[model samples]
Target: MSVTDQHGNIFSIFNDLLKADYGIWLWEPYTEQLYFNSHYLTMLGYSNAEFPYNIATWKALLHPDDANNIVPMQFKIIGSAEYGESFDTRFRMKTKNGDYMWVLSRGFVVCRDEHGKAIRLAGIHIDTDTSEAIVNKLAIQHERMRFALDTARDGLWDWSPATGEVYFSPRYVEMCGYQPEEFPQRVESWIERVHPDDIEATVTKQLEFVNNPEMGDTFECVYRFLAADGSYKWILGRGKVTRRDAEGKAIRIVGLHTDITELRNTQESLAHLINHDTLTGLYSRFYFDEKSRQLKEKHYPLSIIYGDMDGLKLINDNLGHATGDTLLKTAASLILQGTRGSDIVARTGGDEFTLLLLNCSGNAANLILERIQAAIDIYNTTPDVLPVFISFGLVCANENNTSVNKLVSQADKNMMNTKLKNHPENLAIIRAWIEKRLGSEIDIADTRLAQVHSSS
Candidate 1:
């Protein structure tokens, strides 16, 4: 399948050109047998080459990009129930002199097995520029290009500004979930289907070249097109003024449409991953910092809260990391519930979280902290619930505070100070709970707890 549909049509076109070809060749797929007339070898500047050349030899002589294009069409014809389906394609063939010559190869499914699989193919190569077959060759080449475009599922648009008439290729209409006949053959029909937000930007670019043809012949833009499913899909649109008036106004504009929805969605998904925490669905540290910078520049008084789950390591070491992760999620939920919709909450690292509050005073920050603590208390009252607590630092900056780094430093220092006082007691309580819960199946070393406390 290296060569796709291209080689199939290429073979058919070349079959018609056999009337004025430079060389002839035959190949058997199953046996890998290959034959070429002396004129063929001489055409490729390989004079006096021995007989019995393998199909692989001929294939190896094909330009690398072309080999794949041929295989698809080759298999398509070979898989047919009928024989003698001709295909023609053009590709550069490597000559014995190491130079590449553009050769037109056409082949036919002359023989097929009982299973309808093509076994043998014979075709001719038209010279690069044969005077007698130039017209046929031109038409064939145009067909080849059209076939390739169809194979790619790309849509073409030809617009006549004066008449408001437009030709939308079948594939183009089909892509938008419309049957060719059902789709209007007018540019305005297309304009109506564009997403409202994107229509202005998309249409303006096209009109720029149409109104002032001197601006350029080509323009490309990405926009959303409404589909038949009532959904908008991303499309990369490219157009050029094919014909212009004597006064420099565009007459004909032709272009293509390529679906890029999947690509665009992938990019958006990656951006989300980069800016948000995977475990907590909160903003990531990078996002928080960037938001902080923006808020600072805009002269908003901001409160930065830095916190971490107390005894997180003790829970992980005693019960396993799974239990610890549950504790973290619970803490994140409580924190998110405590903050305003306008506030930004982020999981900066394992067991660590931050919150950004705009235009908030120190009292508002304390109120949010108190609300979070209340949530923790309510959860602790439930039977068999593991203890949840956070050691935190609250720092505030007004419009005049220009340095975010200093705010971060003061917040970290205050949170760590609270952690120093609160961690040991939290760890001890968690240890006792784990002992009773698990019947002392696990023991946590004080040294490890000390390392966790100091590291945080």
Candidate 2:
């Protein structure tokens, strides 16, 4: 029969069997002609009247990447009887909207010439773009997850409650100091390595989380793990319950373990630096303020002794800041030695120190001042280049009510008064003593006197 007559009969059969959801097409091999049913043209956002149904039009719509292989494969499959009477392939085809849609094309040779060369071919095209997009997206996601797990050196683990089976990635094996084959893939492998002291509580918490889905999907904890080196290392364990039973019990868990020993050590060092003075190794001003606030709420018998070095500027100006620093260090040591262990001593400023004496009255504070003086005298007798002298003022909290900050201010004012009264005379004596020892006249410009004159 003629090609048009053959197509009319084929269309009659398709009209009875094909649904509106499918796109049907026909091709004549000898003429290289193509025809698209109304559904096929409309599916591509075009009407049958608008689109020219021809081989050239169909080939132009094929995506460049798929055209080279799909076009050849389609012809080969129809021409060779040994291969198959029908063929199925997927490729991108352009839509009238100017975007490509994935199409699953299944074609069969419906007619053959006397020489057995296929004469008429028929096919149905189905839009599988959404499914293909989802599949490609999942493949990319899996590859990204693998790259992140490998490059971050993060250990990954999977646990199945039903089988009591555990899967450990290669990095997880190395994290625990074991080869992949050396470690058994069982839940107990991980449980056994948890430090004895922490395992019970950790497991208890894990069970609680599994039983209560409302708590959250995430589980995180920091605990010590026994390493292969026979030492305990701090680990930050993080995980999510990925699968759960109908009753909300966790059935599958995925997790990561990160070594956090260095991070923990850094945090502790930072805390220490925040609470103590780096130079004097004493409680810092920040710590002192916090302690004082706590003590103020109690209204206990507290005495604050505010002390200032008598000639620190003169020592720094004449001998150098190194000598001034030595003087400060010596004074700090003396204060620490004289104060009770329970007392809080802090270097609150460049030339000032404060001692917080708990459960101490004015009389007790006086005795502590005497002890500080005696300690300084002993230090001076040790043949030091510069004798250390500290002027002190002590104030006690009122029995009725007084804030610690108020007492601190009163004591500081008293200390300043005492310093102004005795500092000039004390400085002269110290300078003369230093000069006598060195057998020379040391010209030390008194910045304190200069400040007084300038202010006047």
Backbone clashes in each candidate structure, one number apiece? 19, 0
Q: Show model 1 residue runs off by greater than 4 Å.
A: 1-152, 204-209, 212-216, 244-249, 289-296, 358-363, 400-402, 441-456
Kindly report the root-mean-square deviation of model 2 from the true structure over all alpha carbons: 21.9
Superposed on all Cα atoms, model 1 deviates from the true structure by an RMSD in Å of: 14.0
Task: Quickly count the clashes in candidate 1.
Answer: 19
lDDT of prediction 1: 0.72
What's the lDDT for all of these models?
Answer: 0.72, 0.73
- Global fold similarity of model 2 (TM-score): 0.52
Off by over 4 Å in 2: 1-152, 159-170, 176-207, 210-214, 223-234, 243-251, 262-275, 286-296, 299-302, 338-344, 357-375, 398-404, 417-429, 436-438, 443-456
Expressed as tens digits, the lDDT of each residue in 304-341 for candidate 1 is 89887777777887789988888888888888878889
lDDT of 2: 0.73
